[model samples]
Target: MKVLVIGANGQIGKKIVRLLSPTNFVRAMVRKAEQMPKLESLGGYPIIGDLEKDFSYAYDEIDAVIFAAGSGGHTGADKTIAVDQFGAIKAIETAKEYGVKRFVLISSLFAGEPEKGPKSLETYLEAKGRADDALINSGLEYTILRPTTLSDDDPTGKVSDVTAFGKSSVTRSDVAAFVAAVLPEEKTYKRIYTFANGDIPIKDYL
Candidate 1:
């Protein structure tokens, strides 16, 4: 399958690009030209695609999409709304236009209930929630993985539906691995899962 990974320059996105590039055709979309070479070296076809602008071209010949873009914690609510909310919706629309079926979204654990999350991240979660809703209603086969506080630690290759093992955070690489593991599986379609680091191997746990 050919997958278009939006925000392929981000931490989790880069890992996903590397994981998918070897077995599937990866169209890694980043915002700048400088970000191209690393993804290329990772065995992906890197292209420039800005979420804040027109990026419809990135969907061409794409069989599936991985919406991994985010505005980051430092950005204001406006940028968050623009990228996380509106940008994701636009991608869903384009995917529909292109007749693309499969989509995987990297979402936050509190997106389903933003008000219950940390006060400082309520807006971010709200934006993610809106994007999640968009993809769910877009008539595309979709999977949403909402992981708790993301850490930059090495992957455990195992995950749980709840926080356990004294580990409250999910590693970015594990999340990427989960996406790769489930992307081609029919059982995960139209599923919304919330997970964290744990003892079950990803393929078995899911």
Candidate 2:
């Protein structure tokens, strides 16, 4: 399959590109031309596309999409709304328009219930929530993975569903592993799940 990985230079996004490139065609979309070499080294076909502007061209010949773009913590509410919310919504619409088979989103833990999260993060959480809702309602085959606080720790190759284990942090590598594992999984389509580090191997849990 050919996959368009949005925000492919970001942490989890880069990992997804690396994982997918070995067996699938990857269009690793990034904001800067300088980022292309890193993705190229990972076996991805890197392309320049900004979420804050016109990026619909990145969808060309893409079979699926992974919307991993973000405004980062340092950005203000406006950037959050623009990138996390509107940007994701636009990607969804474009994917649907382009006949993409699937769309996967990397969302936050409290995205669906922003008010329950820390007040300082309410805006960010709300933006993620809106984007998640847009994908759920976009009528395109989709998977939304809402993970808890992220850490830079190494992958454990195991995880637990948050619905059963409650909130907890997870390594970025493990999250990327999970996304790669589920990309071709029909069972995961149209499913939204929150997860964190745990004992169950990712494939077994799937």
Q: What lDDT would each prediction earn against the true structure?
A: 0.89, 0.89
* Clash number for candidate 2: 0
Residue-level lDDT tens digits of model 2 in 131-182: 9999999998899988887889989999887742135789999989989988
Q: How far is candidate 1 from the true structure (C-alpha RMSD, Å)?
A: 1.8
Each prediction's TM-score against the native? 0.96, 0.95
| Number of colliding residue pairs in each model | 0, 0
